[model samples]
Target chain A: MMFYIHKAACISPQQTFGDIDIEQLHVAVDNKLYAIEPKYPHFNGNALRRMSKSTRMGAGAALPLLADNDKPNGIIIGTQVSGMEENGKFLNQIIEYNEDMLTPGSFVQGTPNTISSQIALINNNKNYNLTHVHRGLAFENAALDAAMLVNENPAHTYLLGGVDEISANNYTLDTLGGWFKKEPCPSDGLYNSTTAGSLSGEGATMFTVSGNQAGAIAKLSAITTIHSSDVAVVKERIKNFISKELPDGKKIDLLLTGENGDARVFPFYQACEEILDDQTAIARFKHMSGEYPTASSFALWLACNFVGGILNIPRHMIKRHGDLKSLKNILVYNTHKVGQHGCMLVNVA
Target chain B: MDRIVVTGIGVISAIGHSVNENHAALVMGKTGIIKGGGNFPSRYSGLLPFGEVLVSTDELKTKLNVTQPGVTRTTLLALHAFKEAIADAGLSPDELSAHDTALVGATTVGGMCLTDELYANTHGDTENVEYVRSFDYASVNLFIQNRYNITGVVNTMNTACSSSANAIMYGCRLIKNGLASRVIVGGADSLAKFTVNGFNALRILSDEACTPFDQNRKGLNLGEGAAFLVLEKESDATGKKNYACVSGYGNANDAYHPSSLSPEGDGPYLAMKSALESAGLNPADIDFINAHGTGTENNDEVESRAMLNLFGTLPNFASTKGFTGHTLGAASAIEAVYSVLNIDRQELYPNLNFSEPIADIRLQPVMDHRSAAITHVMSNSFGFGGNCTSLVFSKP
Candidate 1:
């Protein structure tokens, strides 16, 4: 049931695209992190003008991973709040102008699947297209969908991705909802904070996946999502997942935990750590990418880079750096406040 | 892959409230398109006809015994259908709360149906703060999952009009992949100012009742409702009363326009062809097609071309949108129930309000209700952003 990752591209707050060195990670300013903007001069001017930030980031991240000669068999995207800026504008116009003289541009671009459709139209890919918006489980669901596609139809390669954007109004709303910390903290300080909320961040990560293993960057082993708020139940589930994936009692090389510095949710990560072997090196990424619903996609991207030997582990993000001879297996665990727990396993290709 | 079968179905629309009622209305050629009522207040309220659910929010609350504040109409409609589906399937509370039972729901307008309330609340109007948590796209599904204590793989999809079709497809995949034994797949969407104004801006709302496949057809009338079907593996549904088997399904994007399909209907053609291939059946095996005919000029013409391209000679085809209007996310699920009904009852419901077919294609739909031995039925659902999905249901 393993699928190969042919290519991986990410447009995030870090220096992921056209990277020089992963060691020199980009830093956020004023407790906010935005994806590195992409420039697309070749796109049609009219279409480009109508594309929202989510669409731009999605298309930009996908352009590099897609081969010019081969069209994907399908395009699946996972997003938390797709086109929030456009949707907010649409709502604002309805309220401000009393629903009169409202434009359709924002409303048209505000759907969650607009990113996938835009990418399909740009690439002329008339394949299976879908979008999932299930909070933190969105990207994992997309990945699972890609895996299912590959399993069902092994002849075609698929494009899977996660895209989200941070807007001022959305940030203000999240602040009021106690989703963002009041004080500014450096990206490295996120894992250690005892704050009520974590810093807000957004990005888009795209991967080319298929059954073909030739020249794969990494291999996706397993993905599982559990909907539970009980810490004990989640802990047991994680234990069963690890044993099921590694039935031979093999040690996990590295673990990536989505500890976003929210004090209320950190215990779930701690419970995950309790099940890991003492030698399993634990790493954190929300410190670098900040906290978004699809932050796990960023973690997957980082794990692929690490397994591919393109990135080195940062000392500050590790809780208990385990000793391993080589990078063989990596596990990513993430949880959302809405009771979605997801675990993804990846290995060196 | 294991055979997937539908064990139960539930539906609530402008035309009817349950499967029996909707079937009766369909057989009688009843139309639910009427002048606007309910809480939807718009500038074009009286001028434009909409397929509004006859029940008011208060009435729905009283009927369902809903006591929770800030519950949107979208969730209420979903709960109504979901409860019916589960009950019809004879699922107990313990079985529903099992870890192997999954729930996949879809909705374009979740809590956003309360457009004014959300807009006011987001603007520092703290009086309706309770509504803030209900604004997410997963609110309806979450509410249903929590109510039924569904602990399995719960996911929400939002792919515009094709949302529920994709949900059903996803549920099938989960069972085929051995991830779950049973999955409830459906979608719900209530009428909202957000959608009304959005469609108005697109100029697709019809002032009169829609006339699908007719030469002088006006645009579509927006509708609201919810529908769901309980899906389980054939082995697990041994003793259950199976409505129909979900033999095959396919999804594709048009890659053409955001709001309109290509004149050639490439996406629709490929989706239908793929579904046939997945079902291991030729085009001739299909007894009927439930077209995604939104009663719009662009959709009808393009879909007709697509059907012509695939079947060469079209089969018995009709668009139920003429009866219930376009229910957006809920359209495909509702149509899926209709497809099952067609199979189980061996019936063909007429395409209401159709005088003549499109001049170019010149293919006329069934003009009257009739009984026929049907083997397989194909249901098509196309959405904004060119998302097209086709599902095949076979007699069980």
Candidate 2:
């Protein structure tokens, strides 16, 4: 079953939230990338005043997909760290007060499903709502779920997205754990570095999906996850998916690979590269968006924009340029924790 | 669409370590909730009651032969239940490692079971990074994926208390969609200062054992556990011992409140109504209901009202949370196992710690273990985010 991405929006560290101007991509702060946000004036209420950075970004991204006051049949979200900033605030409150004087304010909004609930609350929608929290497969799973749900009732629409945040507590611990580069790593030279750690970043990307193809930017052709640490096993999975999805030997015009600049885990990207023909253009987003669990969502946003003919492959994103004929099909390939790999294909609607 | 059936089930909870053990305890009307939780040294250690698992982390690690680093208590409990489930299904190694075999796990806290260590790290009081790998909620299922080498579309659901019920629903969808022939789905959550303090701050955690659906019910008792059910296509599960058929599922959002259901119980009513529609059954077809019944002031009344609104009269309904406490992410899965057991055995387990009927609803629950001509069983789980889900399991 095929589902169309009718309307898509993204709030990221880049200028992609609007019709992105490639010249004004966001730069990192000490290798920590943060999403550029808006005033979110539409969210006006006391309840929304308590929205966290992640929830605000999520709702902001998803709000544009829906017409004013129009609610989808479901809102399924995916995130590795939603409401984490609230969590840290609550925990710090407990520690500072010695677990004595703490309110449920922050704790109440700190669940992994808080983003989905906040969106539902704002719209007053009471249809199916779910949140998937996997390492990197979060968005892919949510997308597939949306597809299945839409297939169940093609007349119904669904809103699902991936949103995550990089809190100081998490970033500090992650940096201490060697997940981020020790020194400043700018977006320009992200993949060129020969370092053990990858750059850290966070953002939110959402879409209003439906079985109908009207006013659609792109069709989500396929989405899957390959969970393994072995390069050979991962390579086999990618190779099989490539062959199956592109059975007629049609080359992907643009392949957005989630290649974080970590030299230690570069071989997995190489494995993905091995499956594609040299004629296929290869571009990685981590160089522009940085690396997070749901970075592939940014890749999806890119794929939709490309197929929608919003822009050409930006010079900054071009790693291995090929004949830029037309944007027919694009693939998003990303790895998480250097073990879990995720892939999604977007075709022109 | 293919029919999804439960081939095997496994669970590890505060009441027992395995499915059979839990069933035995249910038959004996034994409760796992204690006056104080001994697992953690939180401020509420002795002040509030908890359904803490009886087993120790080290003992569980040794028992499960899990030597991996960064494996949190949540993962340990999940692995313990996962082992029992696959074994009960009599799945061979080849079948487990097959491409069509998938796993969907649920958890609210993955590696944050060490809430104190996380706090210590945040304050620069400790230089330890061992808990870093477990910080992502996906770590719970990541450990499982690595252990079982499950390559199929593995995902984790974290919709608060309704997490595993959604996972179970997602598993059935996978089978029906021809994505996978089998999916192992469940959830795990262990008591930690993180959750304990969070709930304590909410002021909804009870000081004594929870009494669900009672007039004087104080609140819910926090619990810990894990449960896994092997959901497979009916053709593939034909030769296996089928426990129950995953007939229908429905998920809805309350939207009225983040942590409280609407006074009208719109979410709960829609969920149950959609589930019955999905199952192609009428209200009379549902023989029993494993209600969400958290014993919280808002939940019990609203859930009861929803039942009355939908069925006009209650079925054989009970909240097993009185026995296992609210396990958060794991509650729905554990209760799902109990629901399937209710149909498979043609018997209903009693709801513990119940005395008087709810004042407003004036409805009584199944208070004694009794045999009945059970057929279809409905299981409900509502989460903190107003995410409500209902699942219907029927005789296979």
The best candidate in terms of TM-score: 2
- lDDT, candidate 2, at A245: 76
By summed lDDT, which 10 consecutive residues of candidate 2 chain A come out lowest?
A17-26
Q: Tell me how candidate 2 scores on lDDT.
A: 0.87
Model 2 residue runs over 4 Å out of place are A45-48, A247-249
User: What are the DockQ scores of the candidates, in order?
Assistant: 0.67, 0.76
In the range B368-390, model 2's lDDT, one tens digit per residue, is: 99899889999999888889999
Question: How close to the true structure is residue B293 of candidate 2, measured as C-alpha lDDT?
Answer: 91
Off by over 4 Å in 1: none
Model 1 DockQ, alpha carbons vs. true complex: 0.67
Worst 10 residues of 1 chain A by lDDT: A18-27
Candidate 1 residue A279 C-alpha distance from true site, Å: 1.6
